[model samples]
Target: MRTLDHAACARAIFESIGGGENLVSAAHCATRLRLVVADAPKVDQKRLESLPGVMGVFCAGGQLQIILGTGTVNRVYEEFIKLSGLPGAPAAQKCTAPVLPLPQRLVKTLGDVFVPILPAIVAAGLLTGILDALGRALPAVAAADWFSFLKMVSGTAFVSLPVLVALSSARVFGGNLFLGGVVGLCMVHPTLLNAWSVGTAENVPVWHLLCFNVKQVGYQGHVIPVIIAVWLMSRLERWFRSRVPAALDLFVTPLCTVLITTFVTFTILGPCFSFAENCMIGLARQLSTVGHGIGALVMGALYPVTVVCGLHHMYNVIEAGLLSAGSLNIWMPIASAANFAQCGACLAVAFKTRDPKNKTVAIPSALSAALGITEPAIFGVNLRYVRPFVCAMVGGAVGAWFGTVTGIGATAYGVTGLPGFLIVGGYILPYAELLALSGGVAFAATWLFWQDVPAQDKTPG
Candidate 1:
């Protein structure tokens, strides 16, 4: 069968889905294209799935995802973003939809909170890794004054994590910044810590001062509990205002929510957060027992299909699980390499294609994929080229095997793209050399495997 015109195929997709006007909002998660439409009745899912550059179409989390190859997805996403004006300018918008549902909304909110601060997190992780490396390479550096300064710089983010989470959550929840900051301060308040520490001491306090154990530690950089606290606070504040006379409403609401929510945060929410953290950590430990080979194979094989379902973010919980445990695990490294492999496959197609537009889409996808961003690569390249995607998966399996055998694991929690190295530094020893070798091998395998595929057999959208 003759291949479809790539750009025309995208336009047809837009038109068939009731055009850009039907779009209420759009976003992309780790893999799938998420879109919310004004009228689902007009969407032709079967037709969209058949379109050139489309891999599949389905609904999840109340959004429609048009799965494209890693090669062309980004271009199509960009085109769609321009057609629908989102937060970033037409040219700059990367994701396609907005947050939906309670859990998804919370995830989106946390993502927004963390994304802006990711650079700082990465820098801190890198510095910490470098310090660890320096300690290993030049033991004397640890004794030097500069090393202390480096430690301070790297540790500041984590130590004051609640402050950051509060600031970001305030913006997301549209609450009082000062109150949120105050709440954040309470989480890390020295008095609270001391009281908790002393209470939990082996010599228990003569009388349990409070019904709840004060010794539980607060998660400094966490979002879930704090956001939930603030959301409940907002509701309480509103309720308080309704009951109080108009003259005292403003003062009463703030005072009430702050006091009530603060108590809840410390006594209930704080413990809940710690429990969730432990649960995630426990899950990671369970996954670790499976051995890296089986773990990577299962994760890598399901990676593409997960992308199709927009459930890839669910895998990120595994990374977070590893982070809470203060160790590295098997998921991110393998998944990241697989994504880059998709990029390499896309690049091959871009080079082989005679069409200027397809070439245009493929090149950027190649770059984005290499840098650790794969939306562009997947949507732009691999999804369009079926054989290339399959080859990319093969490459992913190979990379996963390498990671499993070598015990490659991410050291930190960050996006898995090229920047993943800094994250790798968080848990693994000899991070720098290991990262270079692992990343290089994955890239090489992807290029070598997909570069020879015949362009004529590439799949139509």
Candidate 2:
């Protein structure tokens, strides 16, 4: 293999997208160079794909993603930023790509808000799982001082999750992160009843000011309400900044923003949105159990479709709600089933395809999918072939039904596929069974139904 020319690759990408003037922002995540261009039509995508080190190119979530693989993409991103003269990690800006539908935009926003905080959640989740497993395997260890220390460290992220969400949402919505954090802290303050314990607390405290009664409740393990509150805060801060005098703006804007936002949030936004969020979570739990797991089955099958449309991140809100309410994240199992099923379908394609390129791409993409990143398999092999995608969907549906019926759940969120075993706690056997069932179904279906298409007959769109 030839050494990848990072600078040359960056230059090629910059030039192909019509140089710095056409680019609005440039960023990279694990594998792809995510770019927001001034005009979508001006992007010479073919030239980009043909560039050395460029593996694939596509548009999703209102941005053009150049699949440059791991390590390589970040290096190229650094060089690309230099050449384009763009700042690293700027505030979220509007993508000028062909206008996406409202749902797509909203999904993109949620993804932006949540993606930054996933590492924290994943770290905490994995640690929480490990601690739970240790406690179960060695009950006495749960009483150990070191074990207690580890537990506290692991619990901080989940307990302060609203703060994390608020900070990220503020950035995405273009607000001060610190102020946003303050809003988050206010919602989860010690004066209120912990949202998780609201059901069991015998005497729920209420605050009576002038005319109305407000429940002193903390918003823990919640996503939507925190997001709404921060978004309101961001808008208000910006509004106040424009009107407030520069001499007083520094103190006045933040004070007013926090005071007004928290006051309304506590009085109205918290109650109404938290209720709505709860209803949504309740509906999700009901669906997971309804009609003997029919809802889980359908959701599992359709989950990948939402992923393809960039709407799957919305599930993060639901999962966060479930976890916050002291319920297990049952949604993770369904997601894992769906993701692993795709891996199975892709692997089948790898073994069956005679085309050298198809075989090469399918094998690694399948492995990536198995490890919990399915974009490579879904876009590069399964969806491209069409048949395998459907097969995987069928597999996902069956596996999700089994997982739901068996009551498989994870201790946390943001993990799936094989690594899901870590966070599954006592559900290890059932989770493994779910993966096997889903993967087996998908593999068998794809092997029996899908035929290799000639390279010239198909191309990624």
Candidate 3:
């Protein structure tokens, strides 16, 4: 084959596949370009994979991924979007389906909306874990003297969670990013917090009885309500933008949207959140009652798959529930160990693989996994190397089983990566020997299972 013109090839591939015009949504994880197409029939996957810069093509998780080398993927994705059209250019069409039962649809929709934000949540969890570790090592850091700075690092996402959701939700809603963020801010702002706080106060005046106690305190990084609020806000914003007179549109539209959204958030969204939290707690308790060994086994076996489909955020809710209830539960520790187990497995694959391309991906995958970001490892190495992935799962299951048997629990809910060990300090101090033993077993299993694969078997030939 002749040498390929990288940019030209990317453009041709995207154009051939119906360009960004056919996209309902687009996102990327470690190794794949994920796109939701308006018409899957219009796409020519064979041609796309055959393009000069393209490596492969596949559809997974409802996304048609056109695999490109790491460096050029983002560039190609940006150019493709530009060529297709910006959001609301009339080229993009919404998918239609028969109405689903309310509960089932809500559950599925929540999964989709929260997937993209998982990275940020993982980052926040990692930061919290590291800070917790540092505080334990040097108690002075946790004291009031250094409190503000530490809190800023740890609480940034939690406090400004609405903003993060707004950014992600903008892409999902096909609405203005800034406007969406503003709506999110309103949900989590001091005013709402103050109102809720006052209503719940012990000695509040009788006049306040007219105001409902929203009971929800922080909306930062909250999933269900903010997503619902943003979706509504986006629809309302789009409608008003189209119908309102241009002359008075700016002031009138925002004013009305804000007022309506604020009311909805306080009255409907906040209560919904409270109910969801209660449900999640109930579910967690139920899972815990089923014996930790069974719970851990399930988590270990399915954690990687959960991550692959971007459903891992669902687990974060469980962790958050544990935190809200004042102690860590069964999930986070297993999740953390499973992530590390994948890293160890990937590292073993890196050593076993002679393919330079696979080697390039494996090294970074290992590093990121250790740092608490395992997508690179999971996608780049483990998933690709079937044996390694299975090995990691087995390792995770073993680790989780050990932890559960020994009553291992996290003190906080966050990412389960290496840095997360800090969150285990006081909670598992007496059980350090057990924790170490479990980790050792996981590592050993990963190494044993991944070590002997031949170099020729590394890449998909």
Candidate 4:
């Protein structure tokens, strides 16, 4: 295989997106170069996709995302930044793309706040799964010093997830990350009772402030409250900075922001949002168990629809709530099923299609989907042909039912498909079966129902 020319690739991307003048700001994730351009219509998206080493291109949540895989995306991003004379760090860049509706904007904000921190969560989750497997398989080792050390390492992310969420939220909301971290830390302060222990704790400590009682409960394993608190902190900090005299701004802004936010958080945001989050968690749990996993079946089928709409990252909130409440991530299998089913559908397209171009795209896209990244397969192959997408959804629903009945769960989130094996613990066999069932069904269904339409005859969807 030929090595990618990072500088040339970046230059090509820069030109195709209408050069630096059209570029508003840029950032990159594990597998894609995310750009906010001055105008979406100015972008030569087709040219970008045709460029060497680019896997695919699409627009979602008011950003142009170009898929370039992992390490390659980073290198290309660095070169692109150099060419465009842009900052390497992502600042509070303003998007000029078409304004999204209120609900869509909220979903996009959740994606922005959560996407940056998913890597750490995914890493910790993988470790947690491995450690659990080790502890069960080697009971003696589970009691050793090394084992205890590993467990601590594995559990830190989930235990301190609030802090991580706050930091990311701060970045997204354009506030001081360190200050946001303080907000997160305050929520999980050692002095307060752990949120997870609230149900069992006989007597909970409370503070009487201004004719109201505030519970001294830590927000461990919670996501929404931390995000809201940090968002409020960001807004307050900005408001204070703008009005406070320059001489006193430095000291007064942070102090006022923290104190006021903390007061409102413990008294209002924490109680209100945590209650709402718990309700959502409860509802999700009920759905997973209702009518013999019928909820999972529905969710599994609908999961890809959310992805298409760029709303799937919101599931992270629910998954976090479940894990924080001391429950396994039962949601993982549904996602895995949905993703692998897409892989199966794409693979069938690759095998059945006579066109060399279709085969070339489908085979690698299917492999990518199998590894838990489905955008390439979904956008590049399956969705392009309507029948395959529907078939994959059916496969996902069936596989999800089977997985729910088997009762497989994961210790962490942000992983699915083959890499999921690392965190499924003892459910490895069941997960493999789940994959085979989902993929097999999708493959068979697509083979029977989907026809390879020749390029000249294919209609635009």
Which candidate gets the maximum lDDT versus the true structure?
A: 4
After superposition, which runs of candidate 2 have C-alpha atoms over 4 Å from their true positions?
1-5, 11-24, 37-53, 88-92, 459-461
The models' CA-based lDDT, in order, is: 0.61, 0.87, 0.63, 0.88
Q: Is candidate 2 or candidate 4 better by lDDT?
A: 4
Model 3 poorest ten-residue lDDT run = 89-98
> Cα deviation in Å at residue 424, candidate 1?
3.4
Candidate 1 lDDT by residue in tens digits, 1-461: 35545567657777878886777666554445567777889898767755665644656556666656444556666666666565422211223324345665545555655655556655766677677777877889899999999899986765665666666667656677777887877777764433225445665323133786555354543445666676666677667876899998777778888999888887787668767866765665455336656666555545765664445554544554454334554576667667766766776767766765567667766776766666656654666555666666666665665566666666455656566665554345433333344345444544565443344454443
RMSD to truth, every model: 6.7, 2.5, 6.2, 2.4
Candidate 2 lDDT, tens digit per residue, 65-159? 88776578889998998898887445224443237887777877888898899999899889989999999999999999999999999888889
Candidate 3 segments exceeding 4 Å error: 1-27, 35-57, 66-131, 140-144, 160-171, 175-186, 189-200, 203-222, 285-289, 319-330, 348-368, 373-387, 403-416, 421-461
**Residue-wise C-alpha lDDT for candidate 3, range 365-433, written one tens digit per residue:** 676676566766776567765677787787677666666676666655544665666656554553344
| Residues forming the 10-long window of minimal summed lDDT in candidate 2 | 89-98
TM-score of 4: 0.93
Task: For candidate 2, report its TM-score.
Answer: 0.92
TM per candidate comes to 0.70, 0.92, 0.67, 0.93
- Per lDDT, what order, best first? 4, 2, 3, 1
Provide the lDDT at 14 for model 1.
Answer: 74
Residue 444 accuracy (lDDT) in model 3: 63
